[model samples]
Target: MRNLEQVLAHAENHCENNGSRLTIKRKQVLTGLLISDKALSAYELIDFCKGEFGETLQPMSMYRILDFLNNQDLVHKLNLANKYVACEYINCNHEHLVSQFLICVECQSVKEINISKTVMTELQRNVLQVGFHLVRPQLEMNCICDACITSQA
Candidate 1:
């Protein structure tokens, strides 16, 4: 529960304030992601739950749960890979600048990193100058991880 304690508590608090609740199924879906080695697509998560826990949840059900978690910032979606990863900064109460993702193309591993404030500021300025509002900007880069690179060599 090292990763889930803070997340579940924050979710409970947020739901309490919003008149919603984090159901058991939702929590289970989140737990799947928390223990995953790589970002998981909706179908992959469905398979994981069934294989790991003998529970079969419909794809639609998982999708809805994912959407809610995403809205709560408890998870992040990698558009390039069409997968989701649990947010690494959920325990931090303080605000974060920009979040960047480094995804291993070969093994599908994902690492979330925060962009420097200076760079984020300049990037925001550029976007604003172009008259496009950047909402929750996430940069995803595709690369081979060290393990994969080493294994290849």
Candidate 2:
């Protein structure tokens, strides 16, 4: 679990680095995400914001916040689950990339892992050999985790 204060400070620094201001609403949305362990959908986030601010947030507002978070690399969209997970490396300086996620279909748990550099290089080489350029790779696979398998057994 991440320290909420640290996460907020990191978010502020990130905004500063990008010449942006971290607005109150954005901070609330980000704080909500940082405090939760599970990935949340936009609707879930909206509900969270409503409960936090004592006012309902429009879907458009939630989308705008999500878009900002995504662009800032503070959160990642899980295409398989149609949800968003806060990136674990909020303080890291490396540029984010589209990567593979190991998803447990039974328990709905997700783990994100980067593609090996060698594998990416090989893929690029193979695609070039085939007279094609790889733009974005969407790789999501369903599998069972150890805990899930043990629970089922």
Model 1, which residues run further than 4 Å from truth? 1-10, 17-19
How well is each residue in 1-153 modelled by candidate 2, as lDDT tens digits? 677888888888998899987888888888877887567888988889888887587899988988898878787788878888777778667776557778788876677788887887888899899899886664677888889899989
In model 2, where is the ten-residue run with the lowest total lDDT? Answer: 91-100
Stretches of model 2 off by over 4 angstroms after superposition: 94-98, 128-132
Alpha carbon lDDT at 39, candidate 1: 96
- Clash number for each model: 0, 0
Superposition error at 78 for model 2 (Å): 1.3
Give all TM-scores, in the order shown.
0.89, 0.84
**Which stretch of 10 consecutive residues in model 1 shows the poorest summed lDDT?**
1-10
